[model samples]
Target: MSFLTLLRRVAMTLLFILLPAASGWACTPVFVRGQASTLRLNVGQLTVPADARPGTPLYHKSFAWNRLSDGGEQWIRCADDPHGLSPLLLDSLLSGGVTRPTVYQTNLAGIGVRVSLRAIGGYGCFPDRPTPSPFSQRVDNPAALPRCGVETGLFPPDD
Candidate 1:
């Protein structure tokens, strides 16, 4: 091969080595469990860019739940772009008129978070009897528990 051809091949090889040829991607499974009952649930997985920096805003189109044993799941998605955080608010309804919130964290790059659910309002009062409750019971808007805030100087694991 000629000298020019050899130098061109070497330059191309170095470019490929330095740049990532494939997209950087990461998937994490977020589990949301009800606080009022024994029913355990897993929220939909989050597929985010692996190199997502701070203050990156992403949207979750829709999140649905599947019936587990006796209880059902009610979920809501909330985002906070100012704080670089996004989490799903989950409520699990069980027999005997019990409801609780379960929060799932998706922005895994930041500091660890503590999630909780609180009752805002409900349609009907708690039942007096211990028999199976009636349908059509609804809870008013539930609020997402406050996050402890992100810790500075924290970075995600390199994979």
Candidate 2:
């Protein structure tokens, strides 16, 4: 092949490689429990008090995620459900690009994050109840993303 053709092919290859990292939903809060291959959780900052006890979840920064994605995710950082979630707010967060305040709160410090999304089934974690509990539930947001509970890929975006 000619030099021009070779250069074009190399350029295309490089684009594919670097595109993902660049296109990744940057600046958005993602807490991957691998609970579900594609169960994308948009959560808030976790505040575990210095005097808090073990085996007890102080309180998670109320997270939200929907199957819809048009742009970036809007997360409420450091606000631990200070005010109850209103129906309107819930609907907005569960609909499309989040429009809430911008704050950074990633809490993946000691938690394990599953890198693959092709798991046969989703990781069973109870969002309503902490682990080591007798209760466990699957991702069931029928009203929002019907397919959010299904696992399909092993990478970021398009999972």
Candidate 3:
């Protein structure tokens, strides 16, 4: 066979053999801190369900930023599911977009609010490999962001 055809065959073989071993997914989590007299964080969109009640999980992708200003930290867990979020997704939510961590302003419920976001870390990358829990029993700084749960070596966050 010609050199070109032989190279093609080898490449294809490597891809098939490596793809499964290299393929892994993860969920990235972001920490959002809001600063405003009355800040409210809304992810995705606001939808009122018929079963809406006090103290119940809203069953929506949105989060409440109102408590952020009270020395509270909010976490946006990343996942392949619709309820999860990522830095790229947050960037797209802005009027233009943000490339790096910067203070941003947006209107919520007709009120101006300022906020900042950072990717704390990622988790659930290797389904087959046993990993540590993302949460810690003791958080040194409740306001500080948490690090990634799983150790992602040589692989980037796909999910």
- For every candidate in turn, the CA RMSD to the true structure comes to 23.7, 19.0, 18.4
Candidate 2: misplaced stretches above 4 Å? 1-36, 59-107, 111-159
**Model 3 residue 96 distance off true place after TM-score fit, in angstroms:** 22
TM-score, prediction 2: 0.19
Model 2, position 122: C-alpha lDDT score: 31
> Tens digit of lDDT per residue, candidate 3, span 1-159?
999999999999999988887635455455554432433344455454556443223222222333333554343444444355333222332233234222222343212222333223332221222222221122222233322111111111222
TM-score (all chains, Cα) for each model: 0.17, 0.19, 0.25
Tell me how candidate 3 scores on lDDT: 0.35
lDDT score at residue 4, model 2, on the 0-100 scale: 100
Write the candidate numbers in order of decreasing TM-score: 3, 2, 1
Q: Single out the weakest 10-residue window by summed lDDT for candidate 1.
A: 145-154
Which prediction has the highest lDDT against the true structure?
3
Clashing pairs in 1: none
Once model 3 is optimally superposed onto the true structure by TM-score, how far is the C-alpha of residue 139 displaced, in angstroms?
A: 25
lDDT of 1 at 29: 28
**lDDT per residue, candidate 1, 37-154, as tens digits?**
2323232554557776643433312111222222433333232222222333222333232331112233555522222222222212322221121223233222233111111222
Clashes of each: 0, 3, 1
